[model samples]
Target chain A: MEKHRSAPTLDDVAKMADVSTATVSRCLNSPDRVVEATRKRVLTAIETLGYTPNFAARVMAVKRSFTIGAIIPTMENAIFARGLQSFQEELHQRGYTLLVSSSAYKPEIEEEQIRTLIARGADGLLLIGHDRDPKIYDFLSQRKIPALVAWSYLPDSKLPSIGFDNRAAMFDLASHVIGLGHTQIGVISGLVDGNDRARLRVQGIRDAVSSSGLEAGNLTLVETSYEIENGAKAFRDLMNADPPPTAILCGNDVLAAGALRQAQEMGLDVPGHVSITGFDDIELARIVSPALTTVHVPHREMGRKAALQLVEMVENQTAGTGEQLSTRIVNRPSLGKPALG
Target chain B: MEKHRSAPTLDDVAKMADVSTATVSRCLNSPDRVVEATRKRVLTAIETLGYTPNFAARVMAVKRSFTIGAIIPTMENAIFARGLQSFQEELHQRGYTLLVSSSAYKPEIEEEQIRTLIARGADGLLLIGHDRDPKIYDFLSQRKIPALVAWSYLPDSKLPSIGFDNRAAMFDLASHVIGLGHTQIGVISGLVDGNDRARLRVQGIRDAVSSSGLEAGNLTLVETSYEIENGAKAFRDLMNADPPPTAILCGNDVLAAGALRQAQEMGLDVPGHVSITGFDDIELARIVSPALTTVHVPHREMGRKAALQLVEMVENQTAGTGEQLSTRIVNRPSLGKPALG
Candidate 1:
């Protein structure tokens, strides 16, 4: 308590370590810029003095918080966890702190969080998708707060993004499933009202069906929230239809896992009775029995690139460009040819 | 843009909504306190005027941000996701927003994040585990910041916690395994250097071994970071021992998943060639084939209770008490009697 009453400053640390205050600042922000010996001496002095940099005062002077905010759709699953972890690692390497919030797939909640983050002085933001009200874009531009969208990419979008084309990736997988001679198809889709990624994925399946000369209107579709139980329920609904679909494609791996579990409970052999596939090839894809055939997304790369680009925009005040990543199909055991009639 | 030339104030909102300024404030903070019709009128007026509540000014006026911060060990897995989601939900219901940061299981990073969150004006903190430095507790107390620990419970602790007893729970599971007539056992544990939960879990196994009149030192043990790949590597190491144990017990479900994957890769039949068990019966436990025999923790209950208690501490300025939740062993196909030699 007595020690904090007279808080040590950068000057005190410099004097104690016999270095300039600039060097001390460098050590704190970018240790690699300073000599190792000098860095160690400054750090030792800092520990001995119990000095904590006054972050609020720093923000006041530099007009930068060195903080980034990310508002994800949900935190209940591992869908965004892997990418967010990589994004945070890159942010930390560049001496930035990350604060995250989950909106539970509600646009109103997301807008509120965005405003909250901006009010809290975040220099930049990492948003998930590009399916928000244009008024939000206007507000962000008005405030000059740099924000980047991730997870779904658009080639000619007004907003910059660092992700793959959801539609194309899903289309490729759907075409492959159709090539296996499965005329009847079912889709377990995420609710698409406010989520462009889910909407695009479902459209991709439709595109493939129409191109393959199948009656697109004959497709079985069940839209629900992104929970495992919801996925199982949707799968049952699709299967109960007259002339049930031979192949089922899920919006993501979590839903596919649920569908697979329900199939097991119903005493059906995967890829024998019906084929199953999923998107967003998360770790759960391989962990489950009859590993899911899915699309492999470069989640870590997208995260790293988003961090670098968002930081660049914040520092340089530039309008960044979109970079589209590629996705590929992973032909695992979950998807196979339908049984002969 | 023209509207931004003059910002809307509380008086403007009151006049437009035909209510007192206090009513407008109540509508924003505690909608339940206002009549439904009045609240709807205020909300409509707010939307029409594009009036965003001045969060910064409110913070300065009340000396409270109404934002709760949570720091978890890692975000790369689902270990903390379920509980944290519940915590955030409860906070939202109480008109508070949650900001989360991941420490990557590093003590120094956790310390830095703790300071960052406090500096950002969090009204309270929700910390995972109770194994940080004593100086941190001193700092929080000096600042009058209310912090509650979750995920591991301890009685008579200076700090309050809401979680299950890790040591006792693991002890019960180990005793169950030993009772199945397994003379030899292998343990795969998370690193225990600075983590009280991991240390207590390992100690639990030791207690079970000693109580059963077995040679505790003869038990094969491998310690590593909490990752599925690391778990697989540790399992292989344990199996390479001169006399491989019939059953392997993993510290957590993620590690157990890795061990199970490695077993499949080695063409070893689960519960036929080797029995495997895991702690933390998360969703993965059920998703994996030959479901894990593990301990079931009431994660949602713990999260909800922690949020309630932490908010009480912050609002009323009272010292909180530790409340322990109970865990039970889940019997599944992964555990069975050892095969005769």
Candidate 2:
């Protein structure tokens, strides 16, 4: 093994290249400003000395990291993956790097991660929703850190967000199912507390029920965490009730996939005996048997938009403004007219 | 909106609390080292002023961040999610934070991320697979930044790894399938050019074929990326061959799921018309109809072990040692005796 040497610094590179420390810094940060011959000398010296511009020292100098941090609810599923990929790609195109952490859908953990990112000198943050404690917002304000919310949109939210209207999207899907003559319906929702998206989705179902001249209170609602196993269990329990529903609506694609699998296991013929609808057309929606009818949220587009909007806020120090994307229903094999008649 | 004010500094906190700056730092970092009364006074002053200790200054002082960075291939799948969650949990228990970035399976992007993470003062890094530019290893060695590779193990690699033997695991799965009297087999492998895991897996199948008294070179193989749609296309092409395979083995569960879905779409019965097997018993394996007969890697265990080993390296300046975990073949309904006449 080679003998250990202390990590190189800017001054060492300057001394080796016989140039001022500022010239070495310019070569590293903005090479275009340096003359080509001198730049080659500085770069060659940097390579020989193995010098990495200390990010901490640079952060101290410019008060900017050019790095953005994002804290999402979960990484267990691909629901957030596409959008985040686009977000990172866009940020990269504009000379920014992204670091991400999973909060596991816990608000306190999310807040702690936010503070950790801020303390690490993240130029800005991208949050998932707008349901965190007000104190957390106040802290971000006091620290003058800009953050943009994604995955759910609110016109009057405390934090500017770039996403779709979850409530309206779900409502439109529900009304379409009802328009197909599904009167007796069951809903499997994700946990609603601190999840504005889930809560809004449930409310949308109720809105559809009321508009279709049905008793909204009569809807069979099962609240569970977002997991495939949970979705299967909820589906089984819902079917056990007296006069089981003809159609089942789930909060997202994962749950809908579980319901589809369990339905097959129970020897139930999809759309022939019952129908199912899912939200968020992740790949899971199509991979399962009897492909799911779902609301297609433009995840990639939302991600790209969020990145563009977030960079605007970070560079300009202007708070992000809300932008609502649109979603449409994708009618696949899983949905059909109820067989009640 | 409130007007912005200059951010509070360490001097301001010391002046407000009427204590030395070092005392204020002790109160924030090591409260047990200070008197309770004085600690309370300093904390109160900090709260009143809402001071956030600048992370750059602190890094400059101690030369450590207590933050670890992991760069993996993709977050678009759950293959890395479960293991990464456990990795993060273990790091948190040891008073460390984890930040992750995806390399999208590109060597240049991965090297860029590794450099960026190191420059950001990450105490250590976790990488995937042992295949990379040798210069990267030299760079890391010169910088003395500890790193551990996961998901594939090599006994004499440049970096220590904590993972299972991919070639052996896939060989076992293939031999089991062959034992079911499957002479005609088709393989849907991930692109093997730069990925050792995929290359080793393909080699494992070839090993099993030769050991079974079959011509390994004659085995039908289709190469594609790890996407469901690609798997479906590969499976279709394989089935369209002159002599259709009695069994189809996939690189991983994602590919297996796609093959199964496409099989159903083509109106072929699983385990009867064609047996299919997968590697990596991810959630996709169980969720897919017929369930996947595959190799079950100790993902969570590997993650926990990697964390423990990497932290030891970072703290003690000790070089990492390779640890190999085992994998087992999980027999599910997807595999059965070949149906060739």
Candidate 3:
């Protein structure tokens, strides 16, 4: 609220220091151009008066800030760590400082954070997904701001997205499960409410199942938040059904891990009693016992590309068209032939 | 370099708009305060000239930005996630935005980021660990900036630290392992270079062994980076010795999980063949097969405290001393009594 108050101007400092407004401006912007005596007098006047410069006025004058803002859904997992690390490295190489804020998977929070980043003079922005209120897009367009969406690619969307094809990728992984003769499949998906990637991935699996002449309702689905504990609990609830699924397909590795851990605790033999699979081959996938069978997302590649694209859009005023990366299923011990009736 | 050179200023916009400097500043900072007719003139001039405000100059003038910057060692793992999430949530409750950056365990990078945050006019800062160049302390002090350190508590440190006692906490866990009658111990530690917490933890284990009348030299120590794969490799090397120790102590859960996984791969029974223990009872500790015995660090609690303390310092203009938090060993299946000779 105090920051919103009218800031002291160069004219005020000049009047208090008994100097011309031009001298005050030179002292603040380029002290080397002004004599030390005048600069000292100006600074003393500034300190005594508690003067603060108006950022909006200054940004209107300066065309650059060397600041990049990135908005991620959540930071509680290592899912985006590798890619974000590479993105930050590239930004550092270009002498740009990165400012990151998490949205906790809330659309309203993401919108607020976007406005805050813009207000803070971020030259460019890296968004997680292509799903949000279109008004945000309009705001960015009206401001002529550069933004690149990562995590999921949306070719038909108006914004340029730098990510993998969530639908096609998940479809490929699901087809693989179907190829393995997994007819009685169960899915543990992330809550799809504002998450386009999660929703698309779930639809991809459904498309694969329906194309195979399987009744869509036969595939039991459990939607939950993204956490290992939540995944485990969801798995337990899904497993307690009247006729439990013979194969489980999780939205991501985090959930698959929970399912696997729960299965172990429940004394069920993995891949024998029921096969399990996951998306996003994070570190936990390999570390978990009976290493998870999941899709290997190119997080680092996406991160690097997103940074470059956003920076290009910011610097060259070039509009971006969404680019799709690749994803593949990594066969591990978690998935196997289900037991015969 | 281009960003540094092509920065816009208030003077450029005023000259283009054909208005006094006061008018341009008023138009941008408070358009409602200015007449609508003159505001449109300034807006058109801004668009034609492609102007952006200078953040640094504004920060120097406003003294309040409602932005808090946090610098952590790394984001490669979930060690800092839970706590940071809580910290960010608390700040959000009070209508402040959190800007986070990672230093990758580099002191120079941390120092640069601290200066950058200050120059960007962060209202406060959350830093990890108390070790740093004293000149950074002098800089923050001269600028009257508020900062709080987390992860490890130093009672006599000049800066305010909100964390647990690393040495004493590890000492307690080590004593628990000693009580389990494991005299032959192998230690897997994080690289102590520039890491006071890791060094103190290792020392704490050594002290525990010595106090138990066991030869400290018998405690084989292997230092590695904080990665699961690295932990596995270190475990193998430690186990390959002619007489492997009966128990293995890891600096953190990541390393402990690695040791456990490697033990499983080697067909060595955990607890029966070799007992293993880890610090930082992260989710991985529980997720790993045969839940790990580790020190239960209150990460969320520390995060909340760090945020509150930093904000307090920022508002009150007084740095507080270390406030110690408690830690205890979580007894899990990873550790067991030593096998009989």
TM-score of chain A, every prediction, order shown: 0.93, 0.91, 0.83
Alpha-carbon interface RMSD for all candidates, in angstroms? 2.0, 1.4, 4.3
Comparing 1 with 3 on TM-score, the higher-scoring candidate is: 1
What is the Cα-based TM-score of model 2? 0.90
Candidates in descending lDDT order = 1, 2, 3
Looking at candidate 2 chain B, the ten consecutive residues that score lowest on lDDT are: B56-65
Clashes of 2: 0
Native contacts retained by model 1, as a fraction?
Answer: 0.62
lDDT of 2 by residue, A1-341 (tens): 99966777777888999998877766664456789999999989988987776675556545566678999999888889989989988887765778898988988668767866777678899999888899899998877899899999999988899999999999999999999988888999999999999999999999999988998655899999999988899999999977788999999999988888889889999989889889989988888778899999999999999999998998888978879999999999899999857
**Per-residue lDDT of candidate 1, residues A1-341 (tens digit):** 44545777878898999998777766765566788999999999988887766555446445677779999999888999999999999998887889999999999779878877776668899999889998898888867889999998987765799999899899999999999999999999999999999999999999999999999766899999998898889988988988988999999999999999999988889999999999988899999899999999999999999999998998898998868998999999999999998
Query: For each model in turn, which proportion of the native inter-chain contacts is also found?
Result: 0.62, 0.69, 0.56
Residue B162 of model 3 has an lDDT of 89
Q: In model 3 chain B, where is the ten-residue run with the lowest total lDDT?
A: B53-62
| Candidate 1 colliding pairs | none
Which sequence of candidate numbers ranks them by DockQ, best first?
2, 1, 3
Compared to the true structure, candidate 3 yields what TM-score?
A: 0.84
Q: After aligning candidate 1 to the native by TM-score, how far in Å is the CA of B334 from where it should be?
A: 0.7
The DockQ figures for the candidates are: 0.60, 0.63, 0.30
- Score candidate 3 by DockQ: 0.30
Q: Mind giving the per-residue lDDT tens digits that candidate 3 earns over B1-341?
A: 34544645667777777887677755554355678878788878866775644444334434456678999888888888889999988877665778898888888778757766765668888888877888778777766788888998988886789898899988888888988888788999998988888999998998898888888767999999998999999999999876888999999999998999999999999999999998988888889988999999999898888877877776677776658999998999989999997
